[model samples]
Target chain A: MPGTADEGFYELRLYVAGQTPKSVAAFANLKRICEEHLEGRYQIEIIDLLERPQLAKGDEIIAIPTLVRRLPEPIKKIIGDLSNTEKVLVGLQLKPHH
Target chain B: MQEKDDIQQEITSSMRNYSDIDPAPLEKAPTGIDGFDDITRGGLPRGRPTLVCGSAGCGKTLFGMEFLARGAAEFDEPGVFVAFEETPDELIRNAASVGFDLAALSAQGKLAIEHIYLERSEIEETGEYDLEALFIRLGYAVDQVGAKRIVLDTLEALFAALPNEFILRAELRRLFRWLKQRGLTAVITGERGAGTLTRHGLEEYVSDCVILLDVRMAEQVATRRLRIVKYRGSSHGSNEYPFLIDRGFTVLPITSVGLEHEASDERISTGIAQLDAMLEGKGLYRGSSVLLSGTAGSGKSSIAAHFAQASCARGERCLYFAFEESQQQILRNMRSIGVDLAACLEGGLLAFHNARPTQLGLEMHLALMYKTIRTFRPRMVIVDPISNFMSLGTQIEVRAMFTRLVDYLKTEGITAVFTSLTSGSAIDNLERTETEISSIIDAWLLLRDIETDGERNRAMYILKSRGMAHSNQIREFVLSERGIDLIEVYTGPEGVLTGSARLAREAQTREAQLDRTAQLELTRVRLEHKRHAIEAQVAALHAELAAEAAAFDTALKAEQGRDARFSEDRDRMATQRKKGPFAARQGKGE
Candidate 1:
């Protein structure tokens, strides 16, 4: 693995339409996964699409809760409340797929 | 847009008339589509969701997009297009093909197009979720334009995105209700399923109205049809109408027209003055469907050209549909007959539509015609050799198309002149006039080809003309460098004669008349000779008698002179004749 200076840096955006329970769960689950995977190198930004609904169109968001990886080299999106940490790890590329 | 303004006004006004039939009818949001409003009695139910389902490539998306575009542009109601199958750019480009300026509409704040793309690979169903963000986007788009109409083109994409059909169906139901509560007229499209109206049965959700678009192949030709599956709280035309997406969605309703069009009493010439004289000294009534049917090369097109020329001469726009010939060919042929159609073409008073009927389906041809007629705004339309369409479809389909065309032209108050070709070798041999169109046409002019005396000639006669007096006499239809002329045909014991045979027959009659006069002159000379000879004989008899009497008198004078000189000689006998003085006085007294 070619590890550069910002290789461990993580920039994540979490899109939620208002304060729904699933969005909160998704946020909590995503934060726990990132803390366990690489705690000190991650940055999380939360966006409420209800107050600014037009923002959802900018990132191709449709589900209630979505996590978009804006960091590293490739972009990835994981929708719904991230209850399963294994799947979230796989979606975020913290671990390979089964 | 300007081309459709007057026609839409006509449709909506008629729609108002239908809604007025009841004290209070359900209010409708007019789609402003050409014949679609006429079929829906007004339009889809207002402020309610309608389901539009069709198979792949069947124009369901176009229908929805058009609904939104028309509502936003024509009805003054803004719209939001929620596209699931295509992106906003794709939607705009596809709409441009139909002449709808969606991007301009969006810029004018009259439209909003949003693309909802959810990739199944990226979407992870980790926990419970609802499509609330979708609602937010929809609401944002709607509020952006304050739209009254909305279209969710192919919401079936949600099934692929989400593994739960049950949740999608529930969300769709809720979505429709939300749309209804927002008082937005919504159109949600879906793909066709086997034995189902839609893949997920969206009909169960949007219950206000349901439309089914079908594209089926009939004998290797693809035809598109639209049927109103159901309309709640309203009655809609149930027939499957053939539609075409030429410049826009034109649903050709086969037979919904009534016979309530006001008959115009104005008259126009048929361009040939002699033919006009034969037609009750007037011509075809304005806005009447006039038919000129004849065999090939029997001057049908020539006469049609004449009619077109006359219409253009009166400063009316004419649209000529030549199914059998190219425009240049018609122009050239008409020029040979001195019908100056080239001038009319240059004057912008004439337009030509030349296409083989087999090049496209009948519906496509009719749609192109509708689009052209709308744009050109002609006062008169000439379909030269309308019989060429008979080869394109079955008699019934052709009749349906013809009926629709005739009805449309009549409704537009444009005079329609149709030239048809009879198929028989001899026009007189035709068993009957065209069984397909004779019933609907108001005036029928039959052209015939007469072959006699080793020469071929043309003739024309009126078969039928309603609401006016038309000449039934068959006149020899002649085309010369001076244009068409209806010469008085010779109809004697030799049957109807034309061409040089008529001239020969007329000359023969004149020769026979001269022979009869010459015979009468000879008989009068013989009678004069007999009278003069009899008079001379009588005079001779009188002369003979005078001579005899004179001889007798001379003999008596001789006897008296012989008596006077020979009275010196006859004095002897005249001495007795001297005594005849007393005797003569006595004889005189006797």
Candidate 2:
């Protein structure tokens, strides 16, 4: 369950293929950032695309460890491991100044 | 198994159609190696693992490190290096010899080199254990440094640790997937074995891009080449491109086509007014290549230096690459002709790069030149006697290097002047040394020492000029205290004078002709002067006689008038006698 965002806040859905190291790291990194920055203002839907291959097309999952922001006015997607926090934050539109 | 079979069938069918169809567009990350991106058409596909496979000591590690170094240096992208074969120190030390400052780059937080120690005998595998530990380490390293590029040196070691080939294959596939998922441009190096591109045949399956490095001895000369065997979504150069690992790793893309850029039209003076006048109005067009071909001691270097001095005098930068002479020797030799190269050096207008052609291979020499040119950014470059490069490589190799060098110079819009040594005895055979360089050269000047009688007189002639008219006559050249001077040609019975034989014959013939012309002109002038004197005396005598005759006629008229008057007055007695006497006195006075 997730809280509803403000009129301008974003809703992010991080779709991972499996419980690989990169996936776990991406989940951890996203959760930590949400708690630190967007706290109580955003919704995160974590979908394991491997279990449901049909969802892969819904989010257009070409590779694993993909972050799809669904609830924003315009949808944004980023594909990579969540190692580079700054780039991820910038790509996700989660940071005000980058 | 069925899925595997289907995938194989799909691959085969794709291969059949792939040869004809254009490859899919690739998102490439620039490697920053010289001339490498041009061959790969930008660079390797970004975030896709590229496998770098080569035989032992074929510069696989060097290539990998260079890729990472370039990423850090050029793109400002941080990189991580995971080594299973060499320690971090060993890798750093090995790279330092080639001027790759890895440690300093690492210290600057741009690179992180990690050594993965794995003992094959100690690792015992039980059930299916995910390589999550290794992945976590790699992920943590990348995160700590925010790396965009990575290198896994010698992937074979990982396969060796795992006995089962099936497990190895699966693991390698997972590894590649992991790297791609991380969006890292990774270079995984592998050792090549007999009849295989890699040790486990896993590189072909796991890599999205495959680059093969080869070192082979052809005709007792070892040459290194790199070829892209497959790039999944990009069209890469198919030919084997030669490379060198000297001061830095440089890749020479030999097989590129299509040069449609227009060359510059401005002319640069060669510092010789007569020679400049001979070349149409001035000298070579700015950004045009000039070739000076001659035998030994034919003043080829002098001609090149004159061009350099001209460029330097105009406040333009010039680079003089002398392969035969040392810097000191070049300075001294140029000073003899009043070209103070040392002063130019002190003023930072002229740079001298001297190296022995035999000190390195042809590719190495070209790489050095490329690096120097890039760093110096000179407006003019002179290679004093490029023929010396023949001692280091075969004729074909030398020609290829020259072609690339010329092409590069043209592209950069740098005016280049190169001197080549030709044979003294044969004019037709001189082309053999330079091969087909004359075709690409904008201007070709041939210097020869024409031997006749007992004199060896130096002479220079313009063999060809692409867009302008040049002097057709052979100009005699002499080296004196001032400098190399072009003198007028003295045609004798033998032929145009050249060398000592021509000089001596010219001197003798000039003296004889001077003596004969002086005597003949002197005699003609003396006879003309004598004839003018006699004609003046006769004219003066004739004028005097005419004046006297006129006076006598006037006097007779006056006397007749007086006599008539006196006769009329005779009737009046002897009064007319006085008038007649006065008329006679007047006639006598006249």
Candidate 3:
């Protein structure tokens, strides 16, 4: 079951095309942040759009290295290799300030 | 040909193997800009190369840089910029002018910029040479800190280095495939050719999307336009839209139809009361395009100056594009109309860009106008004698240029007033060049020099005004030391009063006829009034005579009756001599 909004939880989907260096970095950066902050309260869904090209439309994908926050009421998206964890976390609406 | 075929076979087989092991789709990259993703049909086909092609100075490189900068700053998606033209330092400096903090992004370990220097003269192409070195460098940069967005400032220079067309084509195809395989959304810039869409024809075929930029001159005006030539698997705006590159490397797409944005309905005074009256009430609507047409010395410049003065007085900035006169000359001439353009210039509310009509091609002129407008951001623009551009090109070119300029002005929602010189005799009729521009204008004012009886008289009339009720009568205009004054319409003659001689003759003839009619009518009325007085006197005299006659008749009848009575009394006295004294005495007593 998806986490409730009252629980202060998040469900993030990080889309990657392949094992490119940028994709691998994005995965690593996201895992590090989620483990440090989200702990067991979040679920990270890794979607490989290249393997199933049709799935790109499910979230209306155009570019790779994009992060989609699915559990939030207002879905948020961030594109690029997730080198800047602060920008990615803020873009995905996972900021601790909130 | 056999060797080329073998190379092509090898490339195709390698692409197949690469695709067969296709990676998973990554997260959606949001550019965080409004309406841009919609045009791309979902941000630029994720990790695919999109080619933006245009002629020189058409904002192709700017568009790519903006995309990369936005990705790095807004999305935190580090970007790799590989420039085949400008150096990294120059690129960073130029981008800084547009408000792109490239250095900061690079220092943050999210962005990498590399300048690839290639000399066509020094390069030696070996048969075994592939773009492997470029791929390696790009890969190393992308991997060093990881870049999600890659921008190749130009692909044409790289293509130019490799002397063989077959090799260039194959290498480009492989480059695109590799970018996709690496999951990088790339922006590639290409130079436009005169006949073909791109300098390297292979760019159009290899990219998932294609955007073409055009810098053209219509009349003598330069305009930069952008069009989506092809967007594979996505719908996009197909029309050529005018754009301006301003601060922040911003590309403002003008002429985007179907956007339901409401324009302001405020009216700005033209400052000339008579001209304002001619416009219906007071002045022109804000954001309206006004076309003022007149022959030589018809006070067209004076009227345009008045508009500019009015706009400046209202604290709104005005841009005056003068093609025929020097800025100093214009200022001196406008002083006669009480317009202190020098003051406006000094105050920084007005700018005058004066140039010869033939100084540049129509496109360059338009580009200059676009650049100036972007820099100044004026609320009002005046192009005195726009018809002069006709001397620079054919009528068709002028017409096309005017169409684009008007469309751009309308899209900007700016008040634009342009003067066109028509022949004196052809007041309502437009000149050949201006005839083509008349349809796109919102309002048209025709000024004519009416020559009647050797007198030249100036008159202005509003031929047409969309969405307003304007005066239909031709108002008399006078250019004096104070300014242009519009007087009541001259109704002296059937013919239009144009020249001073004709106007004077018509005035003389009209005054003569008016005096003659006034004298005749005065004489006739005076005579009629005398006749009426005489008639009234005669009627009174006749009434008095009739009353006198009645009184006289009454007197005569009374005297006869008295005489009869006296005779009767005498006869009675005689008959009654003995009783006559008594009867007479009784009658006297009675």
Candidate 4:
């Protein structure tokens, strides 16, 4: 609430194992949620455990298609494909438009 | 992952009946370990997982590998070994020491070895994860070899690699269930924990059977032991059995109970004439237990050697167990007593088993006896001084061991003789035999040192003979250059006399008899002299009387001649003279 619109960019990472359909859908849903929530002030990184499986434990991921937010204050994790826009917006701490 | 999911679905659907609560009897596959099959009644439970846990170097991995190898080689059951700690090459090289040519078995498509790398740093359990890779690899290996047995060597490696305990526990349970579903008997090795069976407490997940291996050091010798902690529906040996890993694994159950051995009624000689005479003139019964208890230097071993010699002389095989002396020493000592066992040794009719009591455990000693007996198959056995085995174990343990051994010998119909060294001169205190095995002995001969007249004499008596009448007299026994000589002792009011005392008593009786004979001869000579003097007096008197008569006759004849010359005038004179002599005679008579 204290930072202005141009203060900072959102930080996020999508963890997946290979190119599974769930992982692909999770990436698309997460990107759409980021664009709708932060507009032009967001950055996203994608990790595939099939190639970089070592990074899975760093974010404490237990399931495939997990997204973690590394920003502002306390870190948070959201599992499964981010198809629920309302739940994703709230899980990312973004206010819905009136 | 999808392939694993598909297999899992299929396994779950088909394996719904293998519930944890099922109490039905399980099918077993033989482990092929000697003595193990007997104890387990078969082997491990088939189509179920067994947890083998132990500390490091306690033979966990080796046991698993041996089970797999033996299954492949002997039981004709192919096996898959999923090793987490050792590589395939390492396993192949190490397993060769146990005579398992895994490379050859693999080449035959009967054995499969898979190394599952579980590096904690590299293995990251992210998101929803199962051990899908392991399941797929294991399934592929099992199918590749059509294995009936599987082993996951050291499941602790997976416990270390996996960071989440909850996930690991869940996965282990599923893995065990899946192994059961696959209908393959499996073994999972785990490192022993501080207070629990496994480091990660994997015992809770393994359901069918749990086996524990322990390596304990007793008297600076490491002995490996195996015990079954739990078996679901089988009667297994509950005792900790001593096992040895040599060319193969051998587990020995120390004792078995049954008093059903047959007894023979035939009697055999004891080699000593006096000894056999005391034993109803025949000797001990065949397949009977005989105990010779004596004090030190009382010729117990001498009697034993004589028996051994006699047995060999009869063309029967004999085995002598010498705990105190070496073979050379026993043979040499027996030679001095005229019991020349050298011939029997040369002829292969006699054998000497010499070993120190402390060389191994009491169970191992019994096992050695069994093994030797199986190979030798001797008809006669002599345990020279069984008391020496007291140094090996407690009183109860020694009793139990001897009980089993004596029972085995009896069942084999082998005649056995044991010598026990007693302390002090009083021989009736049989508690010194160190074990309660005296009750089983068919014949007990007690030898004692009788101290009398400043000398110790060897005396032997039959204390008990079960089925025969035996001598009760205490015979003076002597170990001479000839052999054991048991002489009937002269028992007096004082006690039994031997050696110089007996000789002195015999000499005193001889001197008293000689003095009485001399006195009787002197009295007889005097009587003869008196009789001769009386006879001479009588003879002389008779001769004097005859002489007197002759003189009288001569005097009368001269008178008659003078009268005849003067016949005419002298006839009257002769008549007068005759008349005058007659008147003189009459006057004298008046």
Candidate 5:
């Protein structure tokens, strides 16, 4: 992927409760998706609500293992462990083949 | 009250069943609004959510803000105000007008104001949003200030933002329950529905307390009233109370507890001596209300001015409310009658509040009066020509306002005098204002213009003086350059004499008395001459009778002597008869 300085960079946040299996799996899957489809142009942040429960209201988070896309205009939220790579890629608006 | 006790028992017993922790019945938080705490007994239910519903411009937001501000300032309870409609800056500015410096409170860490903007079309709700975000924000704000009071102004904005009504209802219920569980007194304001307590029917869920504020416009006058719709575990005033948002939210409950005001047997002068004399040689009770009713030019204002002046003379603060005249005009007129209010005004013992009845609604006028009384703390209050207020409100509203005013004055042990203007000749007919308010007044003085012989005279009479012996005589008084001088009872053959007629009758009586005195003096001289002539004639007759008696006695003596001489001549021959006869003749002569 030929990425411009700002056009192709992705910012994603994974919100979860501690080191739960679902939260761990969701973080790993998000990292893999970003590396395969748009490496070197993507940034990933993991947030454990157990440590910062006060931040749950900022993104309107109720359930754990939620992925939120913050950059590139319109925000989107998806709830799951991100086990299905194709579904995760589709939700993030990436090519399924990646 | 029973319900409250039962709730307390239930709470205490239930706590005993649970853990070792004791749960007592919830106490109330004072609102700090004037007369509001009295009506609410204590105030809003503590650790519970209260729903305040009102239509547009009915002062619901202000009420909620006042509750929070007062709670923070007076109760030492820090508060958090979450506005769903107005921005925090706007709210701060708005609150500043009512003398509440929200910004300062926030800076002191005693109050926290948060604005949550929710646009209905900008958002999409996907699944299972339980308002935890809102809860977290509120909790964060509360923790930041350690707030004990919370206010959510206009909750309908949140309901409008959400798409699903079921979810909104459930979420709102949970929100109220959560607030109650958090043990903070929360005031939730909402828009009033057409025929329901709130547009969202929130009253059904937030059942701890519900208050309704209504602003009604009648005859182009707007009056704001507040009523407590329901308080689950407390007994509260159920009647609608007039409330105003002047410097702050104040609810004035019109109904007094009862007729159990402290009695002040002390009497204060009515300013007119004759009028006071008509009131059983005294004035009015210190805490009583005096109603002075009269027709135009009957000197009602003069009497009121005199009363005010007298009150000032006693070194008591007097508040004079002039509805018909300006302050300058009243002062000028009163000065002309030798009632100089300027000295009192300068001495700070008297305050003249001049207001046009048409300028504000009746309740507004009442609120202003109450506010002034509260600020001035006057010992005496005078309303000149209270009948002029009749033009501003209905009879019922006017009566209610007057009743409340009188009751408040009585409660404060302040004397009050109200003047009213009637229509016809004051003596012939009682004005509608007088008849209606006479019962509530401690003393009712009617000033009438008695038209006799094409001349009008002013007459004053006490219609009623409660708890005192008052004269039943109508005293005709004249307003002169000195003061109001109540003339003595002057009744010609026609009727009571007033004004020039009283003066004329007084002169006539003086003339009649003088003329009768002169006539009696001439009659006394004639009777003295007749007595002297009769005494001379009787003395002459007594001298004539005495002369006649003396002459007859001399003649009888001579006869006895001759007979004795003859007897003696006979006795000379008879030897010694002459000596006895001569002694009898000498005794008869002596």
Candidate 6:
């Protein structure tokens, strides 16, 4: 999804080693959450460390399937498969109260 | 490594012949640290992970860093440093403190440093994950430098960053396997856990080789020690090797040096000629250890200074370690004894390290000495008043330090002169230190204060000399401006005499000889005088008899004439010759 003109935009980067189950599930879970919350204003970039292994050092990546929120005042990171959507939202500052 | 290469060649030539080659020994990668490779026999098991665990600030990271640095610099092997605790810049700065130029090594493409930043506060873990990013980073770092050695410094930080131990453990196992698969020698450092070798029990995972570093602070003196808890495939030094992280990792496995050094029969001077005569007609053996035991103010320093100056005169470097006095004080005092150490210092053959023994732990002192010896390459070393080190540690520890020191010096073929201050009787001091340190000492010279006739004089004798004939006579040594003068003690009828007692006996003997000579001369003069007096009396008697005979002759002639006249004038002249008959009788009777 690309950012829209009329609203606040959300740019996210998902870093993964390869197409593991966790990577696929994290991409799917992240897309689903953005669609329900800010479908038109959110954009996601997928970086496979297997293809661009050098990119891992720049983003300080350790755990596979790590989602880094890029477009925002403060860059935030949420690791794992994003199986618990509520915790993922809390980690990305999407739901501040939680 | 050579064996591995030979085996590789053998395998290629044998072409699957089963009985052609023997079972190959485990190959090792040498760490290039002094005494380290010697103790390990080889080094860390090649292509395996070696766990180096220790408490905080005990030099685990430094050990790992130096391993990589030395590999990259000396072994021509590229290394990767995976830093989990500090950033690459921080690592560079830390390495710089020890004189390692990490940035230069990195720029030369011989080393790579990867900083892995993990904070539990900055990220959230919602589901299962592995440390694939770490693996990828390490792999990339390794590939970037074609590394043969890698250091995962404090890899236990992942336990704090990630919440799941199961995944971390599984990933760590995979990582070690991955490292082995790549055929890279690795050193993984971990923090010491509560009663465990490592915080995350890393030793359990990396079982091939495990090293433990320890830092102990005793009496405000800290010493860093290293020990190989277990090397799975290699025999290593089992003792705790005292190491110094100055400039680099210097592991002095002094105890394990063994008695492998060759004994040279060549003797070197003790600088005092008479003392040399007292000690085997020369001085100490070239590489043997000599113990000079004495009481305070007993010229130990003077003798040691003489040795240092003598060494310099022979164009050999001599390192002097002064524990009780400053360099200036030693130089000044030695000058008073006609030993000018300043000239030796100016000649650049004599180096002095004057410090209080309490300034550092016993092991640190040994390390410093070892370092100085290695750098200075002194052929002779003098430790002035080694007993001052007794206040630094226990007697046993001090003895241990000296034992190692003696072994190290002997192995290097350096002659060592150690001066120890003793109190009470010289015998007591010798007995105590002889048992404690004589095993290390090749010669012992006991300097004692002989109290006789209300004065204390310094006397020296050889207590023991292992391989040479030494004089057993106690020499009363005096320290004058002309230097040490060894005077032979007198053992006359007045018993053993030294200093003023011998002088007094000599004076008394000389006075008795003078009295006897005067009496003999007086008796000869009296006898001569008596003989002369008797000769004079006989002459007088002879004169008297002659005079009397002449008078008698004259009187008789007058009497004859008077009788002739008396025939005419009645012998008037015969009255004048009244003494004639008395004279004639006297003459005839005589």
Best by lDDT: 6
Candidate 3 docks with a DockQ of 0.01
* Cand 6, B chain, TM: 0.83
lDDT of 4 by residue, B549-570 (tens): 8887887787787556546544
In candidate 6, what are the lDDT values of residues B1-590, reduced to their tens digit? 66335533532333333222224577999888766887899778888889888889998888888889899999998999999889989999999998899999999999999988887888888897888988898999999999999999878888898888898899988998899899999999989876567767676577677788889899888988998876765788888888998888899877836789999989888889998888767888899988888888877888788889889999999999988889999889888888889999999999998888888888899888988899999999999878877777777887888888999899999999999888856567656677678778998888888788998888888888999888999888899988899999877886778789878887887888999999999998998999899999999999999999999999999999966765553243344347465554444333
> What is the C-alpha local distance difference test score of candidate 4?
0.78
Q: What would the TM-scores of all predictions be? A: 0.86, 0.71, 0.59, 0.68, 0.77, 0.85
Give the range where candidate 2 chain A is weakest over 10 consecutive residues by summed lDDT.
A1-10
| Superposition error at B330 for model 6 (Å) | 1.0
Query: Model 5 TM-score?
Result: 0.77
True contacts kept of 3: 0.00
Model 3 residue B507 distance off true place after TM-score fit, in angstroms: 8.8
**DockQ of model 4 vs. true complex:** 0.05
Docking category for candidate 3?
Answer: incorrect
Give per-residue lDDT, candidate 3, residue B219: 51
lDDT of 5 by residue, B239-309 (tens): 88888888998887667545778999898887777777777777788999988888889999999888898
Q: Model 1, residue B375: what's the lDDT?
A: 80
A28-55, model 4: which lDDT tens digit per residue?
8888767766877778899876666445
Judging by lDDT, tell me the better candidate of 1 and 5: 1
For each candidate, report its DockQ versus the true two-chain complex. Answer: 0.72, 0.01, 0.01, 0.05, 0.15, 0.74
Task: For candidate 2, write residues B368-441 as lDDT tens digits.
Answer: 78878888999999998788877677677777778788888888788989999988877665866547577767
B1-590 per-residue lDDT for model 1 (tens digits): 55235433533443444342324467899988777888899988888888888899999899988999999989999999998879889999999999999999999999999889878877666666777888889999999899999999879898998876666777877798799889999889989876567777676676567888989786566888899877767888988888888777888666637677778999899888987887788988889999988877898899889989999999999999999899999999899989889999999999999998777777767767877787899989999877777767887888878888888888888899998878647444243346788898999888888998898899999998898777879999788988988898999997999999999999999999999999999999999999999999999999999999989987997776644553244444446557665664454343
Q: Candidate 6 chain B: worst 10 consecutive residues by lDDT?
A: B13-22
Each model's C-alpha lDDT? 0.83, 0.76, 0.73, 0.78, 0.79, 0.84
The segments of candidate 5 whose C-alpha lies over 4 angstroms from its true place after superposition are: A1-98, B1-24, B164-167, B358-368, B389-405, B425-431, B508-590
**True-structure lDDT of candidate 3:** 0.73
